[model samples]
Target: MSADQLLDALDPDQREVARALTGPVCVLAGAGTGKTRAITHRIAYGVRTGAYTPTAVLAVTFTARAAGEMRTRLRELDVVGVQARTFHAAALRQLSYFWPKVIGGAPSRILEHKAPVVAEAAARLGLGVDRLSVRDLSSEIEWAKVSLVAPGDYAVAAAAIDRPPPAGYDRTTVARLMEQYEQAKEGRNVIDFEDVLLYLGRILQERRDIAETVRSQYRHFVVDEYQDVSPLQQWLLDQWLGGRTELCVVGDPNQTIYSFTGATPHHLLTFSTTHPGATVVRLVRDYRSTPQVVDLANRMLSRTPAQRRREGGIELIAQRPAGPPVGFTAYGDDEAEAAGIAGRIRRLVAAGTPAREIAVLYRTNAQSAAFEQSLAEAGIGYLVRGGDRFFARREVRDAILLLRGAARARAEEPMVEAVRSVLSSSGWSPDPPSARGAVRERWEALQALVALADDLAAARGGTTLVDLVTELDERAAAQHAPTVDGVTLASLHAAKGLEWDAVFLAGLSEGLMPISLAETDAAVAEERRLLYVGVTRAREHLELSFARARNPGGRAGRKRTRFLDGIWPEEGSGRRRPGAVRGSVLTGEHDPALFEALREWRSRVAAETDKPAWTVLVDATLEAIAELKPASVSELSRVQGIGPAKIDRYGATVLAIVAAHR
Candidate 1:
């Protein structure tokens, strides 16, 4: 494609980004705003117009997958020789080249897992070496290293930020463990992932000749997801630039959700102040989601605290047509929530929406168990994002071996039947196990293979076991095991940079959404941003739900997340609330006349007591009273949100109103 053709594909905002190929360009890209397209076209246009040499440009992103995608896009544009790499990848390449000259041989083997080393360090310090402690210690050490805090300064730094120590240790002990961890790595002659950047930054600072050579080789830079840049990454980027600024950064402040991993959006937000003459462009036209989805996302973020809100943030304007109004639901318990979502998914699949285009996202990994069990029981194929790979499971491996042996023996039955027969010997059953543990997990994995076999046979008529074996081998080799026909189950953080046709945000209760650990205002703001991320992941259908209790027959004490205060409609208005089911009395099935009468009575009682009407009885309680038509104060006292104190104050009036309605 020609340079003009590249410009032709971009919108006006993207065109501005593509044309501003000079130094210090900032693109304030909103979610689903085509930031990748803008940045790639900018690079391609620069190369096609003879303004940049392909070899001199370096494009950096956060992940290898994203970097590979950029390279593929540039190659498709008929441009090549540009280096697209993660920060660590680029740093490690330079470190490998300069290591022998600067210090020693082969730069130390990279440490793949920090848990064992952390455990050892904790043991030496006489601290507990349990799995969770080791994991938390590893995380804290990484945070300190990336935030540029040294072992001696860790305790003070941690206290300043109010960072609690791991369960078994104090801040001082954590600092000691940090020292021991470094000593352990040195003793092993190895380095962790963060050390790659740390050592490379030191080398570039000390060795000006090497730095100049690197600077000469890569004169221009483009950074994607710049909002996630940590202080250490920014320091390394400064070293790479060596005071020369030929850089363009693309990021969305609202999607800055990795603060726990030492990431911050301060650098992205302060780019203009740092680069006085920079050209700043905002890309807010969202081509990914429908207008309804975009509207919900916008409203969610509008409640962000002014101090934490992005200074120049742009609201997304949906480019797609209107979609269904987002759904809000409440269930009796976790089981009900999961089963309800699964049933809805089955209906959608039967309605022709591909199962692969649906997702169930929650706040934590532990929350996936209920959904997994429900989906498996419903016979819906689902792949848990960031969970164990299907091919890596032992049952799956054993099943594949069984299938391969059966295929070599020339099984004569049909593909699905033969596969099922083979798997039945390995403990595969038509019905899922009643228990929920390793037994259930193994069953689910084998059942996935059965589903795969059925899919293959349907896609290719009259296939044999041999063809199934070949498909399994190919998929295992590619590490892509049967996710094409499965619904996605992911955490909100894992679902970043991904979208689906339908999204169900489950477990939106107070403690889960804001998370019990979110103590500070800033932390709560980030949690809200996380829900915003979840909301925007839908293209057409969106449903947000919560369960009142953790288990059936448990106390229903949970409330909806406070973040949805005014956004979620009031009860009895033909709309859904936190604990109210649609088409139920709490929604609009109750007599409107009685509900209105109850509201008026509550208002009068509130005026007499000089308290708010909600203090007397909220709309949801009134709707419940109207629906139940309680004949006595005892019946009125049984309704939800009506405690003994409330009954003493207004139970008589409420019962009287219910009697009048009856």
Candidate 2:
């Protein structure tokens, strides 16, 4: 391809980078600012210019979604033959292909969800378990394994940590349980997620031929979201790069939210140290948001004085504060807080926002009930996220069992064993113990529960299994019906990466937020990041509400989160204040006169409902209908906002409405 064609294919900067692709290059481009443009064009240029084969370049991203996007972008640039994959996908593919000769048998079946694994391990060890906390412990083990900590190293490092260790929640028990888990996994002849990287790393170390083959296949590698690369992942990248391959990595250090999962920003921030001659670039312009949102994000960054020189040296400023000042509400109790948020969303949609554009976020899954109830009563549509929203959740399942245990004469051994299996199945237990004594204790306890149930059956006349399960279903229905509306009520962690036009950030209380235990710096920082992620998801209006006492059981110790004090200072000027108490707000009313005027708007909108979203309806068109209230098809199309397309599809109906009102 000639220089002119390259210029036509890409903008000047992207074309320059594309043309300069003979050597390793790092492009630090901000969101939506042509990082894909440069990379894809570079691939196209290399292939077109006869310098490199498309198959020789490898494109990688943090997610499979991103990998698909990259592949599509490259095809648009006419860059062909390149392969794109997520790190996990790539590692597993490589490890599986090589595992036959490297390991004795095929890898263990992947533990897609390891929470159940941890839960079973805990129960076997005889520790009492809470499902929620059990899942979090599983998260800890995942972090360790991804960072390349072997079982031996993990046992040593976890010794000082007071948080329950997974093997058996103690030094010796944990170690033995870990060994048992490994033995079980090996017995199954399947590979878990971490095995993909750990075993792959080992294969590369041992087999020079396989390593060289991978290096040859991917001579030029591009890694997106590079700041998240763990040491183990980095080792795999090293194996692929070897001495022959060129590399480009892009990331935002401040976006390092996955550090708890063994990801580190140090690899991105210190890239120059790793390869002193590598080119580096920083992107400061943010193309994703308005100036108002951008400036507020910048202000938030200044508060992070402790950390500097972020990945790609850019902290996004929302392009602008594109919406209203963040709304803050204080409540004395939990129900009021959840209800308040639901009411705000109701009013927002009434004011013209769509239900799909709104999201309700809370600290924990437990707080979703009141909000769900309120939303349902208000006739709002919603989708809840996280945990088992189905009949299968442990809270619901165990309730069914306890109801059964109370009502029926099921054999105690089977039921107890079933409960243990359910807990393990849900990944909701502490690690189980391996010692004979511990095993005997659980088995004996289960056997004892069976004997006790038998005695209960003899004492209580006519207790039956079917009656108990039936009673349990009715109880489950009673508990589950109130939260049936599809409104998305998600925990803050699961709400990341998703954007909403309107968001309600609820339950921001001190002990509830910092959770009474986040006094340490690391925990506090994580909580802050969680809050930030929650804040950034709102593209339009964002509501922050909290309650001092959640229930009658609430103690007086609860306080407003310290975050509010910083954002909304008592000094009068720092925070925005409402005129009235503004508590318990209901849906806003539409004017009678405006309704008469907008008898015209519905005719046009209903006519266009069958058409494409982007083509048939737009905000500008609706705003125009509100202002002009045109009575005729001629009058409606006569308005500047109503163009040829509007006249074609909606002309006659809009005219009919005009005649009806007249």
Candidate 3:
């Protein structure tokens, strides 16, 4: 494809972003605004136009999967040699290459046995923490280390901030545990995840030659999802840049939801201030969601404080036609919410949307249990998007390795029998672990692997051990599992950069959405951004549901999310009601004043553009526009079928229409 082909799919705003490949450029790309396309094409255009050699540019992503996808896209554009990697992976690679020469014999081993080690440390501290608590502490330690908070200073730092450690544990207790965990890791001759960044940053700062070599190798840098960058990661980026500024960052501050993990939107927010004369572009066109969904998202943000929303917070303008009104469901309890979500998924799949195209998203993984039980009872197949990959699970890997050994000895054995024998020989007991929790979960995973072998063999008409082994090898290489056609179950965080035809956002109650622990204003704002992420994930259909009661108990003291206030329209006023709470219906009521005003403006814009009023803004669309009462041209253009071209032509008149009515 030619260079023009790359720019062909991009809108005018996106094209401008793609073309600006030099200097400091910040793209405040809203959800579904085609940010990935813009960045990828920018790199591609630069490489094709001889402005940049592919190897000289480096793109950093948050996840290895995201980096892989970018590399795939770059390859498709016939642009190879550009390095795309996660920060950890990049650090690990550089550390690995320079370790023997710079530090010593070898770099410290990266911590892999985190849970077990944390459990041991807690035991040593006489803390008696459960497996989950151990894991949470490990996470807390990671956050502290990456945030540059030392163990001795942990208590003070944590107390100074509103964010608390998991399990409501006091900072003093966390500090003690953190110190113990660090000592334990050092004793075990290991370094945790945060150490990767710390080590890389230290080496680069101390070893000028090594830093200079890396900087000379990669002249340009692109960081995606710049909003979720931690301070430590930003420090590493600065070290890599070494004051030579040719950086392009793409992110939406409204989507800054990982503050608890030490990520802040501050870097993205002050990009222009940090790099004076930076090109700051905002992409508001949302091509993923319908007009209705986009309007709801915009309304949600519009209710947020100005500081949280920020200056570059652009309301998304949907390019798709208005679809069905978003469903706001209030359930009697958790069970009802799960059943409601399952029923909706079944109906959507039966109607047309594939099960794979529909996702059930929640605030946390624990919320998956109710939905899982309901979906199973309804005979629905589903996959958890954020769970351990089938091939990557520890038990599954162990089982496969044992199977390989057993299959080598008995090459002619049936695959299922071979799997059974290997599992049995490997001391995999049928009885659950003595202490139930993580161990039991591991055993269950092993049993699942055995069951999978049986199912795969049966499906393939009595396959041999060799075939099963070969299948595992292929799947391990592909980093995918056996194809299980099913609906997707994912947490809101995991559902980022993904879309679904229909999405059911469960557990929208006060405690869950803001997550109870989110106490400070900043933390609460992050929680709201998390929900905004969830809201924008739906492409066509969206169902926001909340249970009145969390458990099987009756509804008592259950309250709706405060964020919903001043967002959902009330019955007759056709305006947001501040006191409106959950379980209240968002009725569609068109105000005569706004409707008349819109009609008048539509007529004027149509006359100026030499087109019919319906062409400028059709009656059905005009009705949606008036009811939505979007305050700006950016928002006015979100009214179905209004793309950038029409926005350029009739946007001013439409905004004046709503302004006159107000």
Candidate 4:
């Protein structure tokens, strides 16, 4: 389907970027600017125009999900024979094909043992064996390698950043740990993630024939999220483009929030310098957001702290008022905050926002409890994002394991562990006091359920793997409802590749959002990008909320976000007051005592004005009134959220002193 066929029309910039197929084009596109569209369409147009064979073209993204999504879109566009994969995936494929020839042997087996190698290294570094998780340590090692930081260089970089090591180890230990990890990975006959790039880099640099073969195979290379290209990724790109190869990289520098992850915008911004004759393109039209949302995002970008000299900062904001201003409510505690958000979600759903269209975002996964409880109480459905979503939950994972195990007895050991988790989580109290002989014996029988699955499937004449998979899916189908309604609770990382009707960015406090540690230059820039990514994901309404404290008395210890300052920039930006956050909220923290006070005030105002409660006021306006103690309508509107529609509606009566305080 063309751009015009989609529900959302593509802007001129988007159309041009999407259709452009000539030369070394560098698109400095920001989030919500139809970047994904630009690339997919570019591929489609290339195929249609006969510039290159789809099979000869290569598309690379940062993640597996991104690669799959791009491939899906290409297939939809009828662009066939193209290969799309993560950088690692592509390198691995190339290496796999050539590993046997170069070394006169099969591929190294060390790669498969990355976990055990990391574990051993961590132990030597004095890390707490139980405390240091294999998965987390591997992730750190992978990130370091991709950033081009070797074990020898790890200490210097760690010192430069002054970042603490994973709980059990300090700098010296981590540096030593990484070194040991490198040696172990080598010994295991498997090259870890870093080795993939190193091997590929070597191929391109040491051997001209290999480099030329790859270059010939891939006529064009398209990179997504180009600003996040790490040093090693760039080196790989350099080899691929040896001499001159058509390259197109699209990214938003302001959205470059992964410097800590070893990603940098230096290459993205300096593309023309290094490539020479590179055509730099900047996209300004944001096809994703409505005008109001756009105005807020652009303003936020302009006011960001000292930013690096990078291309693709926010230029055009989408202008649409598909929804109301973002609602902000301060809660006395985490429980109250969750409850308030959950309650609002129920109301939002009842008012027509589909649960899926709404998303509840917070700083950490730990904060979802209150909201989950509230959602449960209201019968509103929601899904937590990331592996931590349900699997990370003790109660939920236990339940899921039961379903997976019982459904697929022939399944691997993960199935048995699932059942075991249920008993343990349900408090079997393994001690003799809690374990009856019958219960213990039943548990033992359950342990052998995997054998039962295989026997059952075999007896039923199920021969293929698909048969067992089908039964498993069937069992899960009979489980709880899969799709959630009302809102999705997710972390920012999990929110990628998703768009929605409304997005709630909760907990925009200083310590949480930019974080206190983000006081440095690079860290602050990343924080800005993180906020930008959150803002651009919204298809319509975007709510940015914050609280002074988790508890009113918890801390002198609390602060509103600096990002909020950008939203309601008090001083004019060469014009009248810039657009402020769009919703209403309650000012005081959640309290039953204040609820009555708030309700009584609502009743008196509703009676005199004869307007619906919402018309007379909304959550944000009331919160503003409470915070500013506005004596009149003029002052109220002047307070951040009250806009013209509000001023014209109930301007007079709202100005009256509420209780005629003497």
Candidate 5:
């Protein structure tokens, strides 16, 4: 209830961050150093001490999920009035509020379906841009917009960044496409994602009234992951601050991985230079990853030359106990690599690690195919993060948008019926196309809508269509990094700000980790940092694996990534033998028999209820049940993360498993 009660929960360094109530405070919060906890507690502490009201504090984060988590944490701290928003969310909110009065009666519609629109534009220009190329072009446009480059200046901008167009395309042609894309969107009266910030920045710069209003409303500001702040995003932040110095920004430059999307750590690295009187704090202790994993991350970053420029370089001292030694394994090919990873994941799950707590991280999205196939073959459920966003699918998005529009109009219709009507209007059918592929995928997505309607109806007990639509919007915003129960298959970039109990870094070979696309020295260094990010995602177990051949018909000789030269096992009478895997990844002191029995019971319960094993009981809870050898239902209730609901449901089964094991 007291400020000190919350402050005492943090480490001494973290406690200082929580107590700093005024001025420009910059925290170089390294991975898993409880950065969110520190920032949340700081706001709570200020509110508790009457230094600032909750409404006076504005907490900004890079992602909607992060903002949502911050809001949840603040609420838990009993400080519920703070405004936590992503840059786009906050800007759009203010822009939406002011646009009606300043510009017109209504704000410009945001361009949601950019890829298809861009593809249509390309078709009009008689250019056959494939899906991949369309996605790349969309990215290029986003980069230019965030960089504040005009369509006419896009070619020069691309050249300045030493970035050429995608293969088989020229810069001038791409520039023309970008122009046409803008024209098409303008024709439709829609503004793309980047315009959210651009519009806000323009309004704040031109209109003093709106700026003053926002500045007055939010007197104190805290920004998480300041390293990823784009130039335009930084401009928006400055407008919100309006020369006021009560700003607390936290980020680690080593984790700056979004440079390709116009995000740079420059803003974070130069914060103190801009605000000379800023109080800087460095958090070096890593509480998320084990010593072995932290050591691997440090070793990878230490090899990079530019790491020193980012303030105190990443010297992450692992505060956790020494975990298993880092394991490096070599595979004959991608198939073998995937199989190896799946086998290990299965072993970890069988050893009492929840499937959701294990992750397989790779360099590219394309690399997920083999792993997905392997996991499916191993009967292990896994969720891919990048490029597989369910809500981002075109048909699903169209259906949701239609429902949202109808809901906003306050249509007197049931939400489920509204969903059905929207899907039908969108030309989605109950029966999937006889043929497989895109049509089938769309059909499946629409079917999922029906299922979601039923589930929401059951959960909300006959909620209004408008409320359901609002729920959809909230879910979409907070779904950036949704925690689903499965083996996490994510690209290294997507794996940032996330941690796992056991992580398998696959396709660690040279052309893969640094990917042949990293042409420049800066790009190569970023690639190394990406590796560092992936390594640090592992908390207890870290396994780095590579393959000699990526595909069956690919080249014969495949070398490990140049970044891994020092950390990876060496070949031919070196420190570690080539093609040799190091350390047992499935090491734990818990009784293996009891653990397996608990897992068997969990699987059975999960199947009976059609839920994830973790939903019945997480691996940690199961491990506790096994290790503590709970003799009865009452004893099982004492395990952490197990509550009255779990005790009422699975406690008896868990206790029986323990007794049977004994």
Candidate 6:
């Protein structure tokens, strides 16, 4: 394709980017804006116009997947020989090429994961070394390295940013651990992933001959996701540039969500100041989501604290037509929230929405258990992203093996009872662990298996232990166990760069969304941006919900996320009020006397049953019952939250109350 043909396929801003083929250019691209298209076309246009030699052009991004995408696009445009790779990939390549000539025979073997080394270092330092602690320490080490902080300077640098030490360790201890970790790596003769970048930067800085060779080969550079560049990455980019200004970078400061991994937007925000007379283009036309989603995304960022908000953030403009109104809901507890989301998903799937285009995103991986259970119970297939698969979990695997063995031994107990007995022998407990983390996660996975057994028996009468095992095997096989065909369950951080037709942002409470560990102002702001990323992932349908408590009978002390203060229904007029019961619409009117009577009866029954009042019937459902005045079991079943189970349990009593009111 000719240069003119490439420019013809781009929008106005993208065309402007393509035309600026000879200078330092920065594109502040918003979410869903075709920034990839813009930058790739710019490279193609430059190559077609003979402004850049295809072999000398290098495009850098943050992820290998992203780099592969760029290569694919460039290949389709018939522009070949451009080096498209991640920062680490590029550094590793350069390090391998120059290592033999500079200081050694061969480079050290690369460490695949820092956890084992981190654990060893922690043990040597006499620190507690649980799985979570080791993981946290590994993250802290990566953050310190990427921020260009040395072991000796870690304490002061960490304190300057109010960065808390991981796993309850003090700053001094963490600094010492960092030093010990380096020594351990050196002793093992292995370089970590971060060391790949560090070593390459040092070689480029110390060896002028090597630096010139690299600089001469890659004359033009294009960087994607520039806002997520760490200080070390920027240092490497500078070395690659060798003081030349032939560069084009693209990023959106508002979408910067990886700060916990040492990413910062300062580089992208200050690019123009560093390189004067740079051609800056703002890509605000969002071609992915509808106008409603775009507007919510804009407002979500606008309401961020002034100190935490991005300066000169780009506001997204919708390029698509209107979509469904964004949904907000509150549930009595986590189980209800999960079940409600599963129900809505079932309806959407029945109404012609593909299951693969739906997602239930949360703030943490530990939150996946409830949704996984609910989806399975509802017969909806799902795939967990950035975490272990439901059936792939160790606890689930162990329980299934135990059940299969028990079935072979001809256990005489009922299906659910026999399954519970096998699981109990393998450490399954009736109550959840008091704390959260790996232990709690294990329990939840086991509980899900038990629930699966109960559901199978209830759905199919006289289900034997053998039958339950067969059902498990079939589900494990057909749930798209490790594929992308089912509904996605992912953490917000993991959902970046991915979009869907329908998105349910679950667990939108204060502590979980902002996360209790996000103590600093900047950290909280990053959390807000994380939610913005989740909101913009939807093309049409979006729902945000939170449960009042963690467990069904637990205290309802949690509140909605403060980030939605002015945007939520209670805070804003002329908007749909958030439903107290999932999938229920409120008329905001009810018979006062009947509503009170129903609440009283709910309290009495909850006290007798040792459950929460909402478990009997939430206020919204009671209000719905009062207003609608359902007088029969059939009529009562028509109310929201009144499914077959509830109807069988409370239908007659509810109808009797309505009769008395009448």
**How do these models rank on TM-score, best leading?**
6, 1, 3, 5, 4, 2
Candidate 2 residue-wise lDDT, 213-272, digit = tens = 777677888888787789888888887887553887776665666665778878887777
- Shift of residue 496 alpha carbon in model 6, Å: 0.5
Error of 4 at 456 (Å): 49
Each model's C-alpha lDDT?
A: 0.82, 0.60, 0.76, 0.63, 0.76, 0.83
State the lDDT of candidate 1 residue by residue for 1-662, as single tens digits. Answer: 88999999999999999999898999999988889899999999999899899999999999999999999998888889999999999999989999999987778999999988998898888875655456667888999999999999999998998876654468898899999999999999999999999999998999999899899999999999999999999999999999988999999888989998899999999999999999999998899897567767876775332323347566676787545557888788777999999999999999999999999999876566567767777878888897655565566788899999999786687888889889998767998654323344566677767866876776678899999989877666544434458999998999998899999999999978998768899889899989999998999889988999866656899998987776676654423432243334443356778977776676577567654345466555666676678787666666766779978877777777777879
For candidate 4, lDDT tens digit of each residue in 37-124?
7778878777776777898888999999999999998888878899999998998899888777776688875365466887888777
Between prediction 1 and prediction 3, the one with superior TM-score is 1
Top lDDT: which candidate number?
6
Measured over all alpha carbons after superposition, the RMSD of each candidate to the real structure, in angstroms, is: 13.5, 14.1, 12.3, 14.5, 17.3, 13.5
Task: Extract clashing residue pairs from model 1.
Answer: none
Off by over 4 Å in 3: 123-126, 166-170, 303-310, 387-483, 549-557, 569-662
Summed backbone clashes in each candidate are 0, 34, 0, 20, 2, 0
TM-score per prediction, in order, is 0.74, 0.68, 0.73, 0.70, 0.71, 0.76
**The 10-residue segment with the lowest total lDDT in model 2:** 579-588
Q: lDDT value for candidate 2?
A: 0.60
* True-vs-predicted CA distance for residue 260, candidate 1, Å: 0.8
Estimate candidate 4's RMSD in Å: 14.5
lDDT at 99, model 1: 93
Model 3, 443-496: lDDT tens digits are 556665565576566557768777787876864554343337788889898898
Higher TM-score: candidate 2 or 6?
A: 6
Of the candidates shown, which would achieve the greatest TM-score relative to the real structure? 6
Task: Give the Cα error of residue 260 in candidate 6, in Å.
Answer: 1.1
